[model samples]
Target: MNTPAPGPGTLAEQILRGVGGAENVESLTHCATRLRFQLHDGEKVDQAALDALDGVMGTVPQSGDRFQIVIGGAVANVHSKIMNLPSMSGGGTSRPQSDADVKAAVRARGRGRFAWLDNFFEYLSDSFRPLMGVLLGASLIIAIASVLDALGVVDFRAEDKSATWVFVDAMWRSVLYFLPIMVAYNAAKKLKIDPWVGAAVMAAVMTPNFTGMLAKDSGIPGITCTTNATLGTQECVARVFGLPMQLNDYGGQVFVPLLMVAVLALVYKGLQRVFPENVQLVFVPFFSMLIMIPVTAFLIGPLGIWAGNGLGEGMSWLNGNAPIVFAIVIPLLYPFLVPLGLHWPLNALMLQNISTLGYDFIQGPMGAWNFACFGATAGVLLLSIRHREKEMRQTATGALAAGLFGGISEPSLYGIHLRFKRIYPRMLVGCLVGGVIVGVLGGVNTEAFAFTSLLTIPVFSPTGVYVIAITAAFVTSMALVYFSDYRTPEERAQANAERDAAEAAEAAGAVGAAEAAARGEAAVTGDRETVAADDRELVAVGAAGAVAPAAAAAGADAAPTAGSAGEGFALAAPVAGRVIGLGEVEDPVFSSRALGEGVGIEPADGHVVAPADGELVTVADTGHAFGIRTADGIEVLIHVGIDTVQMRGEGFDVRVEAGRKVSAGDLLVEVDLDAVRAAGHPTVTLMTVLNTADVASVEPHAGQDVAAGAPVVTVRR
Candidate 1:
């Protein structure tokens, strides 16, 4: 009685269709929440249709060269299919038509900020932007520092070290390190956000002398700064409670100060609700600082530092206890990095401690893992560069700089990882081969350098035995990259081949429809479409704006004419937004409270309207997201944003439970929008499809506003 949901690939194909098909696309990339792309002809896109998509979050014009589609978590899957979509010549490679267009593509950036925790990743991403500059500074400083220290001009020996060495090592070690924070600050500002406060917190956290203070290096205010018979004198103790802190004079403990600021922001938000705005600012920041600083310093900072140091110690212990097993871990993790970004910070943290840890076992993982992946990406880039397009070469060339030398993986990971999925096995083989060599030969860590390339391969080969193992990593990676049949030469013969193929196929399906389209295919900017759910039981959705009721679909008032509405579908509340976890729930699932694996909602008394108009699928609850399959086979996953799971149900209200059939206008859930707002969160509701491979099109129903019964999305065949 029900059809299976469309696969994620199907949804990608449909998205390509709406965007004038694969040939129309020039190139694509992704951020936290959107699929950023450049189309050969802006006129060919159906902006309204794309926005009206049921699973789509929204659309925005970003920078100068990009048109962005908000697709949330499904972005990666969709991006892959779009890239691999079939073209007339055989492969659908995005090709730009003009030099100016290529230049614009190189310069444009979208104004979206990822989650605060992802700041670590932002640091790495930003590394590529000023890659040459930052690397130059780091390489030159380290190189010069190494030279000076060797020449006896610089010393940190305390007994023999010069003031110059002390100053440079203590202060300059992390000089270009804050590059990540700076990048995020500039990027967020472009998004129109004031990040001065956040940046200030980061600056304090990264301050050279701050770590010492947190480590109890700065004289504890109340505790007497005295010579010790137990342990050592205050001046000699570099650790507190068996915890390590890398700093000169002490004072800046990052976590506590950051916590203070965050708590202060929370206080400001709370007071703004009742107290007058003018009075709240001073009091909020003032009290937040007053309450948080002492608490953080005396408690949080010490605890966090201890935990961090302990973690490092534990890893050290593990490596010391079992060297062989330790050697193989990196190769194993390299393959999984894309799916589970868990160890992303391990490299940075390893670097942070390397100054003291001396030789590291962790470096074993670094050898062939990313290098193999990087080699694979290099192959993809090289292939892209040689393909018959000059404009694409320019962009691919820039991307290769990061992929080849700097080891920033996005351009390679997203650009090549998907294109040559089969190359993964070879990459893994290479990694395992390297790991086996490390484990067998005892490849101890030298020291970590910032670069990840073939030239720097020896640093990883501490025993100077890298002739074969490291070479194996490169040869394997390159072979896989080159041999994997992601595309063929026949495919790159012409530009726009993919688009022409799709158009021709569609033309074959309905000549009459094609004629009608020819008559009305004029592109209209700012157009909107609204229609009722085709069925009584499914919901209809529109963008986040005032919706003209279905009665007005033909009333000539339906805004932005000539826009086509995709087929409709229905959705149900997954969980109450505020409820953190249901009974027996495990893993990260959507909460009714916030996004991640949660179903967020607007609470109040309201009908459970159809999310979009399609036949109902089971309203099963994983206690996270409400899983529903549209009639057209699109699987809709409506999740709330991150970390709302701990709320325990005070954050939101749930109206319709699972399996309640209703029309597009039927109220599904009247949410507690105010409660969520009061709790200080952007109520950006995301209704995404986990299985978007089969979905043909998504129509946006959410606009700048939402009244009752407003259509937010339309899915199509």
Candidate 2:
């Protein structure tokens, strides 16, 4: 009694069921390759069923009732489907939380020794993540303007530029000039504080009244300006209430707002605690603004400015003295840093360099890393096309496009590079090659901060060097990944077999639907309704007709047996055992028949054999299960033991592979029952008809001792 198919429902319905229905899903979210669920009760999830799902690649159960279902490139589609289900209508994608829920969430977030480190990275990522669009937009504007400058159509750096070109400059400059305020707002929101308060405090310093004091001839009292000889930049100080306060331009200064918001959140939340709830909002923002504005202008602002400039100068010194070492280190470090969110500080330094030094040098070498990442994705795309892996091809195509055009690497990083271990080392070699070229040819610099993409190539100085470095990096990574192949040979074979089985199942479904339409029926055979036949025809004249000839040709040796009304088949015991009903099985999913009608066997020994002759459609990597599809379209699932997958093939010797034709009683695997028991897993062998609903009836002959290959289950189509 397999879990009865939810007829006519989409894959989302199946996923919802596998996650223990909508009621169990407290909140839902998705990333590149996985559907993240914060469940109300983790124990209710059907992990085995999810692993067996067609679209799902794997299931990861985390602490605090959190679950992640890996769906590869199709995650977004599957997530949309799940959210659109009628059962999910009561709430939005993320449900409202109660006091208990909040507490539980907090407890769940205690992710061991590095919890603070996790929170820190998450904070950094969220703060900058929202600004990516505007940043990319600004970078592209710079790219176009730089191209015109390079073509001699405009003197972009001239102080006497025409109004039209100056206006053009302002277009991209708007995003960078006010970046501090934007970062402040986002950082405040991430910390659960009043975002407007954070923005106001940072905006105060960038205001005309504040920046007007930077002028040496300003008539304002208690203000003085000086120019640094080394950096050739103006510095100002204002005497406010009989104290000297450093006055610095906060435009395009990300670190200032990042630091200011951290302090503001503390003050805002503290003010909230002091004031009554009704009057708290007004007073909290009031006090937060009052306290943080002065604090930022007098302390945090200068500190953040000095800190950013100090770091930028340090890197500049490294590039000046040892350009080769600096170039090599940056590209190599970025591949690891970006994934961990530790690269945000370096990104801030890049902006700081453009703002203070009027140019940035880091991005030139960094382009190597970006192109290398994209090149590896290209390799995957090529391999996917060769192997006919539709999912990988789709994923790699999108990731490569994002990388090359938008200069965004998260898609390539999370979607493909991280999943395959071999890609990183090969990509690193590309990074090294590109870095060396840039260093040996003299470092490239960009006046305007820009994303390292093909469109932004004009922004870098000495474009030839930059182009050559990136090309070398790209070609190296692409060749290495394509030649070596990402997946091991064994894994590749299994993946191809799974792909073939999925294709076959799709073809069978299409044929079934066409036949149903021909007979003027609205549904396919999957609806589980028996078809009415006219006279006792020797052969079934329907969708099954397509496979009847092959079944007949195989004759008595084949798995199926012709019945009076329809096609039928019998399944044998995979091991010498006493057959027991599914209800007696320890696993609830099987006991409830969610995976269809089946029987469990208490095996006397560990010699597992094939139950029928057909194509072995699926063989689990752990040797715990195998799916056989008969010539007459009977799908049988033979599972070795309860939770034996946890053993990871430690004591099981698998003798068969997927896509192979096997006869009844052919050796499938030899398991060590004692090893399974020692590992605290039950040794009951369960066999079920996965597609029982498609057949007429499936009967189990349980409660009897049976030898290997003895008939134990009967299926009728």
Candidate 3:
């Protein structure tokens, strides 16, 4: 019989179950290739099930809290699968809570569409996105252009003839002349502005007539004048009172347009403050045109040309003064360039100069390419093959091919490079090593108009040690990753199994001691019963004010000490909200209340803490409650309710943050019924952090009653 296919939720459950259930995952964030998880316990992982998933690419157990899962290009897709789980205490399931699970899940709160969107923006545009197209194009053009120029230069230089030289010179020069227009347009669009305006401005600056005029003996001073002719002599594109005067040629300059647009944006935004929206659009554009055009023409344009020239000249000087340093740094920064978007503007000058003067300065030395995509994918592929999980192995293999031949780099970045946090640093080191090889070779076979990978090596062309450098970089990175990586499946499992056996023996010895002593054994009850049967008991509200003792005589291992808040309603950190001011950890939200009115609420878990002082007014077993009257007088009413109450009991683990003076967004409970549902329960969740009687406006903003910690009624009196 054919095996049943795992649905998204089912697939998610299996993955979570294997990684020590919902308790294992510390927090989750997704990229294009895999789910970036901050996990607490990776040792108990069910590697076989994780390996079995169709989406998983490979696995790497990073040294930090992260457990990297290579899930192909469907990371976001799989994240959707995992998030659909009904939540329990602190993003956990219905399993009895552990302190580690509670503390860890606190990192997962405050994740919303906006937060995700912000991260998504960073994911796509910041470093890698803008130049990917240009990088590819540039690399290809460099190869092609070099060949064309070489054909003529070889013959001309060899025979001292003008014919071949003139033809090559004319064609090469023509493209260079038009190059500024392309850069300006592309840069403008990337900045979210009108491309046509940029193109028009660039075209005006680069016009031969303008160049011809500027070629005057000393230099033509800035005298803004208007000119319409596409081919005119000594004309200015912008005007000073309609007087036609000579001006500097600065077309194709990157920063000129950016400066103009930024100023225009400021004015436009300021106009919105004063004018109505309809007129704001018109007048803003009109005013921006009047202001920015002249400023750009007179000030920004000239400066940009000067700056670009200066930058190019500076780079030129560096190459001359310390060619070795230039070589070393270029490789160091090149790989980083693709990922950080800033590389486009910086590298534009190099490409421009290459177009102007045959072969880039790297033609002598000081050149190299980043082998990130190739090296990372190759490493991933090796891990995939070694993985016992079939689907994960297959995805990894495909991701590798994409990096090698298809020229896409995501597989390399998400699938391989980030497998271990340290790999990022290692890749940078390897890139530099390879860059030295190419930098020293400094012979030009191909010039990149765009960035690309190893297959483009021949384009760098027929012979050169630069080719060897590129190959060496890949080999070096792959080798490093391989060695720096973790043990394979069988090995890790065998080690774990062995350790478990040892632990079991020790436990047996302890048990034997207890048995012999007759009264040495502690009577076990529930999950923690094995630890301490005489545990201090506290309230565990089921649905109503109806409560059960959290544990019969359950004692906190580490109770409040000096400076720690004493137990009142015992806020027990409801739902694992990250505390700031009581600040600590990754990204703190708001600080303590020494100077403040209300405490900040940037909860890490999807649960809320009652301010420790509230009347347990009405609990409907639907998992919602209202608390009142604290020293702060904020009258906090926190309701742990999510969906249709299918997760009624599994919904919340409340300890109370009200009734006692509590700060904002405290962890009072742990709720991850979402995982409970994903673990095969129905999807109904207890919803709302509510308001019973009412207040004018909630001190906090209210939101949809979706999941626990989801905003319900933030009432204000």
Candidate 4:
């Protein structure tokens, strides 16, 4: 029975069911290509069913009670729909609401003192993951401004500018300048609190009245200001009531908000319990903000700044003293870090560097990793084009565009790199080479937190060095992917065989449709079964006429060659059995000619022999299948039984090895048909001409019993 494919919503519903419905799910999140789940009971998940869903690419079970469903690029939409499902409305209620419950549910993978470190990284990852699209948009705007600056059209860095240019600057600066407020909101949301309250608290310190203290004439009493000789920036301090407080601009402060939100959540939740349920709505926000605002400005704000500066300075010191190690390590680490969402802390540090030190060094070496990722995708695209792999071609094209133009690596990393095991190692080599080059050239630096894309190349200093390094990285990975290929040799052959079979079926179908039209039947809307019957009859008549020519070519030598007389060759019976048509075979791989034109034989005896004179190419370790190549370029595969690989050499004994010459009637293997049947497998041995597509025609002889020496298939090349 044929089941219709499901839409995204239906597929999402199926995924929910496969994961043991909404009750088993404790929390859900999604990245570029995976729907990450924190399940209450991982054992309850029906992994096999989930992997077989219509839109699902694969499934991954992590060390914890965590599972990931790979949905390629449409993962975000799927995640949204899954969260909004009616069945998921009360999903959270099934599990406890405490922090311990949440931790116990998601923290199965880690234990001991270091476990908190994992949770901390996860908190940081969730806070910034949702901002990726906006971050990329802002970076592109910076790229455009840099391009204008390069062409002498505008001085993007100048404080004095026209209204139009100032408005243009605001396009990207809005995201970076008010970044602290954004981080606060996201951090609060991750902790299951009111996000707006966190945003408001952060915004209070950034207000115009609070910032006015920096001005000497307009500021209130007890305010002092000075200019730093080293950084060439203004610094201010204000004494409110009795305590002195350091005044900072607070623009683009990431760590401050992250720290403030943690405190706010505790205060806000405590207020919720103290106030009556009726007044909780109004009193919670009122009391929480009244207390936390002062606390953030005086305590959390300065502490976060100190912590961020310390981390940035440590990295800066490393870069200054040991530039080579720092350069190489940044690129090497990113490939591993990006996929797990663990790189957000480093990103926050980049923003901190720009706000404090006036420039960043990490983006320069990091560009090598980004381009190496894109280069690997380019390799996949090249190979897909050469092999006519349409699905892979489209995937590679989309991923490459996102990587090069938008400076997004998630699309390529999840859609292509993570899926292919061979790509990461080759890509790392590119990363290493590019890093070495950048380090030797004294490294590159940027004054803005620009994304590492082709358009943003001008943002980095010494554009020549940056370009050369990235170009070498891109070319190296691309060549490796193209030359070595992403799939193994056996996998490639199986894929090729499937493609050949599809093309052959399509050609045969078209011929059948044409013949039906010639017989005055309806061409476009005719009964397909009638056309198929006619095609089979034509094949049978053609087979009868080709036998005489095949025998003439054989010249009584048993194995026939096209050059001797006929158009191609003939394959003799490999074992004594009833001759069955290819259509009668139970396995679709043989019945549909997916592995090329073949015949099935229900063996009457245990003995098997060579069908034609050829050299052995493959002898299965399980004693099931053998591949032989003849002199006229005819390759044939003799398979002993259906689904017999599971027998593991139990019911059969091999008498030959690969790369050995053998004539027709050579002993190959001895099989026990009763033993194969008792093991719940078919004892039908199949003989297929593997290179049938390269020949003129292949015809199967069936419906009657035949001895081991009798002819059963004729091939014309």
Judged by TM-score, which candidate is best?
Answer: 2
Writing each residue's lDDT as its tens digit, candidate 3 over 190-270 gives: 555555555555565556755655543534454345432211223344334764433665532334544554455465466
Residue 624 in candidate 2 has what lDDT?
Answer: 78
Error of 3 at 687 (Å): 31
The C-alpha TM-scores of every prediction are 0.38, 0.52, 0.36, 0.49
User: Compared with the true structure, what per-residue lDDT tens digits does model 4 show for residues 31-150?
Assistant: 555688888777777764554455665565544577667676798999988888998886433455588867876777575367776567566666775665565566556656766676
lDDT, candidates in the order shown: 0.45, 0.74, 0.44, 0.73
- When sorted by TM-score, best at the front, the candidate numbers are 2, 4, 1, 3
List the candidate numbers ranked by lDDT, top first.
2, 4, 1, 3
Candidate closest to the true structure, highest lDDT: 2
Candidate 4 TM-score to native: 0.49
Tens-digit lDDT track for model 1 on 355-463? Answer: 5565555755565676666666556556555543333344445445654454444445434453434556767777777777777887657565444544345566464
Q: What is the lDDT of residue 455 in candidate 4?
A: 70
Please list the residue runs of candidate 4 whose C-alpha ends up more than 4 Å from where it truly belongs after superposition. 1-92, 95-113, 151-154, 158-162, 215-219, 266-284, 306-717
Better of 1 and 2 by lDDT: 2
Question: Candidate 1, which segments miss by more than 4 Å at Cα?
Answer: 1-193, 206-220, 223-307, 331-360, 387-430, 445-464, 478-717
Candidate 3 Cα deviation (angstroms), residue 629: 39
Model 4 local distance difference test score: 0.73
Q: Is candidate 2 or candidate 3 better by lDDT?
A: 2
